[model samples]
Every structure is written in structure tokens, then in C-alpha cells.
Target chain A: MSKAVIPGMIARKTGHIINIGSTAGKEVYPKGNVYCASKYAVDALTKGMRIDLLPHGIKVTQIAPGMAETEFRSVRFGGDGPVRHRFTKVWTRCGRRTSPNWCTM
Target chain B: MRGRRAQAVEVRGLIDGLMVVRLAERGRQVKPEDQQQQRKGTHDPQMCWLACELTASGEQEVAWSTGPHAKVAFLCPMPKLILITGATSGFGEATARRFAAEGHRVIITGRRKERLEALRSELEGMHGKVEARRSFILFTSTCATMPLCKRSFPPTGMERDRCAGEQCGPRRRAGPDPGRPSRGLGAHAGHQLKACCT
Candidate 1:
């Protein structure tokens, strides 16, 4: 994709590439090892692309969304619908959405 | 101390190996069911295949679950040629839905064909081609069956030209150039949008 677009973007001397990053890129957790590492790589590449593509006058921005409702949880967990539903219920019930449901911590 | 305890797995070798196998089997048999199940985040094979394509294409997704405020700001100048990744579900889908409803010229992409198709039909049915509607919904995996220059809905085809309002000449998609993964699209097409959006 970069091979194809960089030429055009460089030639045009006008374009923007916004790469989606994650908080995982900057922080680390137990089960988030791979995701964190991958996001870190994204951050690295965003920096690299910013530097390299700067001459061509292309804007490179990385958006590291903290978190929200998305299929990410589904993808991370797998396609098990019931498990996902129950898990989300538990998650939302806990303060990610509502509070006083389960303050175990 | 807390930061030092992270144990990141080194699965680059395994992932790279699998990607190679997928690349080798590019033009082989694919199950339509796999195509359909892609939207729901189901089917391991489908997800892996789409992930491989994205990884191969080297396009970073730009989705966020924050809100329409930030994105709406980005898509300013009003109607945008938005190129969303993972539009099959979640924020991607919601963004696509909002944009389509507002009648923007979008170029929505995702790993799921069925979901993409479904979105197209719903949008068309509700608000059919209201001027700024050359919206292209690209199912991430390269589809050979889909033509190069036409307004495809479910089995959507991508033309380099949008706004299907203008003469097809101005917007005609370029050739299946070198280093492009599939058709006139499936490769640098994402960057093409980046340039076009600029």
C-alpha cells in the first residue's frame, strides 16, 4: 500500500496518512504483550513515515484511541457469542460503563 | 518495576510464515461462507486472510471509538472521501453508517464482504445515490470477480473515479500497476485515497 501510494503522494506533494495506533503502543500489560509490541511498532513506523514522508510534504498522524465499544474485544476473545455477551455484561456492569456493580479491586 | 515485568511473545516468525503460505495460495479456492462470516469477527481463517492482506498492503487502519467530533473534524470540508478500515463492525461500521446517512462520498473498506454489502444495500435503500454518493465499500480481501470500473454494491467494484456524477473519464481507476496486490485496487489504493482526500 505504501509502495503504491507514496509515489502518488510524493508526486502530488500533498497528502495525509493517518495511522491508527493504540495506548498499547505506549504502555504494557500482562495479556497485552503482543498487542502492545505491535502498537509500539506502529508508533515507531509512524515516526519513521513522518520523517521520510516529510520531504514529500505529506502529513502523517497516528491516532492512539484509548478504548471504546468496538469489535476489538470480540476479535481478541474469539467468535464465541455467548461468552462475549457475558463477558461484556460483566465488563459494563463494572464501571467501564456503570459503577458499583463489581468493585473487586 | 511494574513496567519491567511485561512478557511480550515473539510470534513474528509464526505470523510471517503463515502470511507466506497465504500469499502462496492467493489465487486458490475460497469459501463464500468465509466471505460472509468475515463481518461478525467470526471465522479464524477469514480473519487471518484479511489480516494477511492488510499486513501485506502495509496500510494502517485509522479507526477510533472516541466519537464523531474528532472524526467529523478530520472529514471537514463537509463531505469526505473517507476510507475506513475494519468497517465490518463497531466504530468502523458506526462511522460508515453516520457518513452514509449524511450522504457523504465515502470509500469504506473492511475484511467482511457480506457486512459491507449489507451496509451498501441499507444505505441505498434508505438514501439512494444523493449526488455525493459514489461511495465505495471495499471488502479488504481482493475479489477477482468484482470488476474494475463500475458501481458495485455488495460485490462492490472500485473505480479510481468517485462521484460517479462526473464523466467516467476523470475518475477512471488507473491500471493494475506494478506492486499492486489486486486489480486496480487492493494495494496502494489506500494511499490513493490519502492523496485524493488531500
Candidate 2:
């Protein structure tokens, strides 16, 4: 992605690359090996891109969001609708909407 | 439910945070002292506060979560061309919508062609032009199919080379991978294995 658009950004001498990361990238959990690894790679790549593109005046920022109501939980649960529903129910019941629900799981 | 409302607020807060990052440098004059401070590895306090507010404080969420129709007073003077991946759903979709609502040109890529088209139409309806494509440029394991990126725009050679790093990891993704993975193991892996075996 950066490889494709970066040349044009360099030519123009300005660009902003905002990577949507996850809280999984910041902390590893018991069963989040693969997902966390991928996000960690994203976090690392964001920093790496920031450094490399510093000379080119391209800004690379990564926003690591905690869990929210999205298809992300469904995808993470392998499309198991019932499990995700029950999880979300339990999650909301506990009243931690702003806090990351990864630890409880 | 309160949870649902909270989720909506959280998502909107995220969109607001992204806007903050987008507008952080907007309409601000660069002073000699600021440049010297930047050179000295110090950042402006306001920028630091904005950055910290994103990750630390709930004040940002409260500030932007006034209502669904809330709009930032200051808009970007020039609409930026933004490329967002995984825009079929989740945060990506929200971000795309936020930016498109602000009248920025966007290029959104994802695996689901139907969803991508739907979003493209919805965003185009909201603002102006939007480019949608089915490109998986993130995972290098899927890079073998880089040349097959025949969309509205041509794939660059550097992009092809970046995807050419297919030999970096063991190939395991078989089922349910959103975008198509190239058939057969990457050819580069074959050469490397052959050399080591010989």
C-alpha cells in the first residue's frame, strides 16, 4: 500500500498514512497469538514507516482502538455467531464498554 | 441499550480522534523556535496534548460525542486523497465515512467486492468521487498475486517487489482468506529451498 502511493507522496512532498491498529497490538493475550502478531507487525511497520518517511515529509500514524461493536469480534471468533453474541452480551453486562474486553476473554 | 449507545459513542470518538490527527498541523504557522524545538527533539505541547488525549483521556470522547450531527468547524483547505484498506466494515468503514463526510477523496480497498461497491456508492453519494478496489497489499504472503492487481489503476513495480517477499513466512492460510492467495508455493521459496538442499 505504502509502496504504491509513496512515490506520489514524495513527489508532492506531503502525505499522511494512518494505520488502524488494535489494542491487541499493544498487549498479548492467552489465545491472541496470531491476531496479536499481525497487529504487532502493523505497530512496528507504523514506526518503521514514520522513520523512513521522515525525510519525505510523510506522516505515518497508527491508532490502536480497543474492542467496539464491529464485525471484528465476529471475524476473530471465526464467524461463530452465537459465541460472539453471548460474548458481547456478557461483555456489555459487565459494563466495560470503554475498557478493552480482551483480558476477560 | 446503554451499551449500544456507548459503542456508538466509542466509534464516533475514534472518528474524532482521527480527525484530530488529520487536523493537528492545520492552519498553524511554523515558527523558527518551533523548528528549533523540533530539531532539539521536543514537540509542541498542544500536539503532545492532542496525541495523549487520543490514548489517555475520556475528555476527547465527551468533547466530540455531542451528537450524531456534530461537525468540526474547521475543514481541510484541500481535500486529501486517502487510501484505506479493510474498508468493508469495522473501524475502516467508519474512518472512510468520516473522511468522505468531510469531502475528501478516498480510495478504499478490501476483499468483499460487493461490500466495497456498496461503500463506494454510499460514500460517493455522501460526497464526490471514491475509488474502490479489491487489493490485499498488507500480507506479503499473498504477494505472489501482485501482478494480478489489474484494477482501475496500474500496480507499480515497487509494489510488485514489496509483494515479492513471499518467501518470508511459511504458507498456512488455505481457507477463508478474504483475498485470493496465489496458487502453489511462491517460486522464490522453491529456489531458496533448492539451493539449501543442494
Candidate 3:
């Protein structure tokens, strides 16, 4: 993706790049060692890209979404039941403890 | 009986855009117009759209599925040009395949040039009706770790940086001698991701 944009960047001398990140990048999850590390790398890349490309009038942004209903969890856990239960229990417990009102369940 | 009752209430909410007033019991002096005004002040149009969809679908029973605003907006009139990395397998490959099937001009990239070539041939053969000019697959050695590789492309007329860094993953510290190009494990992974996006 970046390679495709390079030619344009050289031509216009400016550009912007947006990368999708996840909360997993900001905080580590159990058994998510490599994936977490990868997301962290994305965060670092966003910062670096911003600095390196800023002079050329390029902007870099990173969006780290939390608990989005994407295919991520199903794929990560290899199925829906076990991993979903575990994650829901953990997040629900955390939500209840942190903000009971917000934790409707 | 309990589930049936809940379903009836949910159906009512759907017909009324999930208004809190509609959920209130009979003769409950709830002013729905006021509540609607208050919600409109805080919620955006996309949120309103999502709320309507979820309530209509009866998924509102799930606590996590409370507001329509939680949904991601689907891009209409799909983009003509799309670039995907990690196109050799998994989500990237699936997405590239889907978009190409939808008749969009798609460019898929991956470090495994052979895999990309195979996919390209397969998609082209399958999508004979769609012009070959609309789809392409490119192979690149660099992965997600190296952004500089893509920085080399000539800028087309499109906005150069409208959504930069939004979809890119995190970065790691450059290994010693940044100038020296080394294909380590990290670089390989980086290349894989970059390949999909290209």
C-alpha cells in the first residue's frame, strides 16, 4: 500500500497516510504476544511517518478502535464460544468494577 | 412468555426508532419529542441510521448492541481503486477477492510473488466479464515494517494524504544501521503487510 503511494508522494511532494490500529496495540492481552507487538509497531509507525512526512505536507493518522465487532475476535479465538465467553467475562467484569453504571449487564 | 413479551416491546421500539418514550408503559407521561431533540443534539446522522437498523433487527437485546452509532458506516458507490496488502492469505486476501468480485479495480500486493500471481490469474479467469484493466496484483519485497518502499510511487491526482496512518499498523525501532537493508523476521512481516496494501 505504501509503495503504491510513493510515486505520488515524490510527484506531489506531499501526501497523507492513515493506518488502522487496535487497542491491542496500546494494551497487551493474554496470549496475544505477537499480535500485540505487531499493533505496537503500527503505533510507532504512525508517529514516525508523521515526523518523516510532515515536511512534505503529508499527514499521518492512526485509529485504534476498542471492542469493535469485526472478524478479529472470531478469527483470534478460532471459534465463537470459548474465546467469546472468556473475553466477555473479562471485559464485563472490568466494566462492572470500573463503571458499574456503564456496564449494563 | 417472558421472551415473547420482550420481543413485542422490541418490535414497538423498532417501529418508533427505538425511542425511550415508546418503551415506556401505557399512560406514562414521557415526552418523546423532547427526548428525540436531546438525542439529535448528541447523535450524528450515521448513529441515527445505525440505531434504526439495529432496533429493526432485534439485536438491541445485546447490551453491547445498544446504540446504532456503534456501527461502522458502509462506503456506498464503492471506490474504483483499492489497494490491499497481505493479499496472499487471510483477511487481506479475502477482502481483495471480494472487492474484485464486486467489479472494482483492485491492486493486491504480497511478498510471495508467486501467490499473488496465482491469485491474479485465478481472479482474472473467474471474472472474465469484468475488464482485465480493472484488476491487478503487484508483488513487493518490503512488508508493513518499511513505509519508505511505498513512498517511492509517483503521486497521482488523488489526495496524497487524505487518510494516512489510519490503516497502517504499528512500527518498531529501526534495527542497527538503518541504511543497511536487512531482511530479518520483522522485515518479512512488514513486507507481508505492505504487499497487501500496495
Candidate 4:
């Protein structure tokens, strides 16, 4: 994003840059180590860019959504049906707690 | 049954009120005194801006739905050109696919060449292929390929010192014109909402 899109936005003297983030950027939970790190990086980068690009009149926004029902679950579990079902069934009850059972992909 | 009946009456009243106001205003001719202001085009752009600000709150609720102001939103148009990174899988792939489905130009980038190629094919079925080989290896144990961009584009040594935005003026403007009067939600419309430009 920095190397390509941002440069273009700066040159244009006007542009909107939306960085789609996740709640993982704010709160860290089990099984979200790498994801959280990346999201945090995005959040920080977004903040820095927003400040730096103000003079250039470039707009930067970060939209962070929570727990979307998408292929993310399928990809994360590698198509493990029972585990996926267990997580689906117990996610509400057990998601906040970082137990080994809930932690594994 | 009683609740449904009440709702019908309320809706009827609302619609009637709206039309009555419209009809009453249409019937009244402007005062001779007010015609001077009209001839002079004395409406303040600032007031136009103030009115926009007052209506901004309610506009959010109707942004995604079929509202009259959904397109252009009485301000500048929303952004159309987008660059989606990490497009090999997951959200990136879905977002890029959506832009293509809507007949908008999209540029999807990722480290995975095969995945990028697959996405390009999916987005462009048998037409419009523009390929440029610029390898930027983001995270690696070694910095062996760090200077690859020096040759075809800007020299690597000087480019690193300056910000990418400072260096790429014409390229950026030539890329997209999303800040114009766009559809859906207006991007770059208000000063406070400058961040929503994307």
C-alpha cells in the first residue's frame, strides 16, 4: 500500500485511502497473534499516514469490523469440520477465554 | 391488527404532510424584494455547506439503502479507483471481485504471482491485460532484491530519501479521479471528513 497506492494519492493532491482493518487491531485474543500484529501495524501505519498526508490533502481512513462470517473461518481451520463446528458452537461461550482448545486453528 | 392500522395512518399522514408543503411552496410566488437576491445569485456557498453539515447525521442511515442522495450525495462523488493488496485470498479477493463486478477499474497486488495472475484472469475474462513486473519483496530474511526497483523506475538511492507521494505526482492524478462527484457516498466532500477520501 505505501509503495504504490499512497504515492499515487500524494501526487494527485487529492485522494481517499481506506484501510480495512479488524477488531484484532485493538483487542488481542487467542489464535490472533500474527493477525493482530499485522492489524496493529495497519492501524499504526494509518495513523502515521493520516498525520503526514494532511498537508498534501490526502484522506486516510481505517475501518475495523468485528467477527465477520466469511471464508476466514474455513481457511483458518483448514476445513476441519468438527473443530469448526465446535468453535462455532462454543465461540460465544469460550471465545474471550484463551484456552488451548479455543486457541488452536 | 390495531398496530398495523395505526402504522398505515401514520405513513399516510407523513406522505400527505410532505406533499402539502411542496404544493403550498409551489403555489406561492416569490416576493418582489426577494427576486433581487435571486438575480444576484446571493446564496452563500458557506450556507450550502452549513446545510450539508446539518443533514450529514441522518445521511449515514440511508447511505447503503435506495435514497435519492445515495449517488453523489449532494457533494463530491465517492472514490472509484482502488488498489487492493493481499488479493490472493480472503477479503482482498472478495473486494477486488466486487469492484470488477461493478465494472470499475481495480488493481490487485500481492507477493504471490500465481495468485495475482489467477485473480487477474477472474477479473478480466479474455481481455484487458496490463502487466508490469516490479518486484518488491516486503519481508524477507535477506535484503538481496531490495534495489530491484532502481532501474526501470526512479533510481533506488535517491528514491528512498524522498517520500513516494512527493515523487509520484503525475502518476497519481493519472491513476484515479475518485474525488470528483462520485456515487454512493461522497468522498472528500467536507473538511472534517477528509479522512474518508478513499
Tens digit of lDDT per residue, candidate 3, span B41-143?
A: 2445544444334433432211111343332221123334556676776455665655554445666777778888988877665444344335464656555
Better of 1 and 3 by DockQ: 3
Between candidates 2 and 4, the one scoring higher on TM-score is 2
C-alpha lDDT values of all predictions: 0.47, 0.47, 0.48, 0.42
Q: Candidate 4 residues A1-105, lDDT tens each?
A: 343334334434566777877789988989889999999998998998788777778888987765433467667776767877777667556544322211111
What RMSD does each model have against the real structure?
20.7, 16.2, 15.9, 17.4
Instruction: Give stretches of model 4 more than 4 Å off.
Output: A69-72, A86-105, B1-79, B126-198
- Candidate 4 residue-wise lDDT at A53: 74
On the 0 to 100 scale, the lDDT of residue B124 in model 3 is 66
> Distance from true position, residue B9, model 3, in Å?
41
Residue-wise lDDT of candidate 2 within B1-198, one digit each (tens)?
322111111222123222321212323322333323222233444444443333332222111212223323222345454566777777777766666544455556677777878877655443321122112222222242233222211211122111212322212242133254423333332343344335
Worst 10 residues of 2 chain A by lDDT: A96-105
For residue B35, model 2's alpha carbon misses the true position, in angstroms, by 44
Chain B TM-scores per candidate, in order, are 0.35, 0.34, 0.35, 0.29
Better of 3 and 4 by TM-score: 4
For all predicted structures, in order, the TM-scores are: 0.50, 0.50, 0.41, 0.44
Model 2's C-alpha root-mean-square deviation from the true structure amounts to: 16.2
Q: In terms of TM-score, which candidate is strongest?
A: 2
Cα displacement (angstroms), candidate 1, residue B10, comes to 56
Clashes of 1: 2
Best by lDDT: 3
Place model 2 in a CAPRI quality band: incorrect
Global lDDT of model 4: 0.42
Q: Give me the overall lDDT of model 1.
A: 0.47
- The top-ranked prediction according to DockQ is 4
